[model samples]
Target: MIFLFRIGFLEVSWVDIIDIALVSVLLYQVYKLIRGSIAVNIFLGILALYLVYLIVRAAQMELLATILGQFMGVGVLAMIILFQPEIRKFLLVIGRGTEFRENLFKSIAQWRNSYHEDVNVNEIMEAVKTLKATRTGALIVFSRDVELKFYVETGDVLDATVSKRLLLSIFNKNSPLHDGAVIIYKGKIKAARCVLPVSENDHLPPHFGLRHRSAIGMSENTATLVMVVSEETGRVILARNGIYLRGLKLKQIEQKIVEYLQNTEPANWEEISEEEPTTTEN
Candidate 1:
């Protein structure tokens, strides 16, 4: 390798610069993934332990160094266990980036037209508008390429057609099924009162409640579009691929759903509407 420069005893080269750049990018991505969660604290704790281990070993403290060395030896497995969700999310990101996955998703979109029917977007929009007006909280999950049977099994099977009336009734504050989420697939309500995994993202605004967190978690884990209506503020929030758009108008929400179903990218927030600014709490 050709050396570019020398810093005292250390030689810097093009390969070294490239290696450092790649490692920096990787660390940045990992930090972004776990930034707002409990995983960050755990990550820091592990880093601290490693630092201590290095110090002890350098000082020739044999007893402490040996114990720390053993811990370090098992750190890889321990990290896998402790950060399972983060690891899964990381792998999912990598998988999504592959050309094969993109082609597969495109194929799935085509298959929907021949095999699976789409849900009534108008009915869903109407129900969401009503829920927002009435300050009735609701979580609705729309399945995409992935089959969410595992999550569906967690709730009551509905097998009912999608309708504004049915959605309103299901999410009525007094209704028993109002507490959990409703899963929609193939133009039908496949399940109701489904328990979704709540996100541990600490970066989520403190104002966001359990409903929003659950929506984020479900979206992160699956290729689904999740809608959440805040019970407290009557704000309509839409989540896709773990990205949450808060205070969206009914028209904006409809357009997003339509675009997503049509296998096209949704309009950016700025393009959605300038008159109605999207507000993200926190």
Candidate 2:
């Protein structure tokens, strides 16, 4: 309460505003990291305990304050131990951001345009047709901006050119690499047999299998398109926008991929069906 040029104690300073802004930013980042996580409960618990400790200390309760003070002294180390997984995940996310990666949207937009200009859509169509023809089960994840390094770490890193034969071999039942999803980035197969997240959709059709669920999960988590084909039925499925498009034929799948890849727009399955037939007679 020192006198600092205030007529009626309406004192404020630039340092106070700066401190508030810094705290706000830190809290916002923490909220982002802990959202949809159980670590938030642990955080609130620590905060509540701190408030109680402060109250006890202020009331001149020697025993309670002494016990609470001891807890407070080791609280930070306890928190780090208890929330080890969450803390590691948060640090990984922050580290990834500072790893000198290029802009995500710009990279995606480049791929979208490059696929149309540089890549051979006919060859891709041929591969898609071949995949459907053999009734080969396949899961191909096309990565855009968001990195799938965690999932990629779980698989064999190929970093090879995307080709029909390579994709077919990976998805062939007899092949060693047929077990998991292939992650493609910038026209290269960055990883093969990569495990992916699974969707918990209750309304999914009974026929939908694990590959579809994993594809939906990957799509939901990142800005990527997951293409899945069922080996038993030769049916094609595309996972994007957190929705699964089941029973898509070659042309429809191609169109949907081009639409999402090039435009980043939500597709209307109904409109697509009305505009083009699902099947093409041989």
| TM-score for predicted model 2 compared with the true structure | 0.60
Q: Flag clash pairs in model 2.
A: none
Residue-wise C-alpha lDDT for candidate 1, range 1-282, written one tens digit per residue: 899999999999999999997676667556645654567768899999999999999999999999999999999999999999889767766676663355445444563464557879999988887888889999999875444655788999999999999999999988999999999887889999999988767889888889999998877656678889999989878877667886576788888777766556645532464355454422
The per-residue C-alpha lDDT of model 1 at residue 73 equals 99
Error of 1 at 222 (Å): 1.5
lDDT of 2 by residue, 211-236 (tens): 88888777665567788888887778
Which residues of candidate 1, in runs, are more than 4 Å off?
Answer: 1-115, 267-276, 279-282
Instruction: Tell me the whole-model lDDT of each prediction, alpha carbons only.
Output: 0.80, 0.70
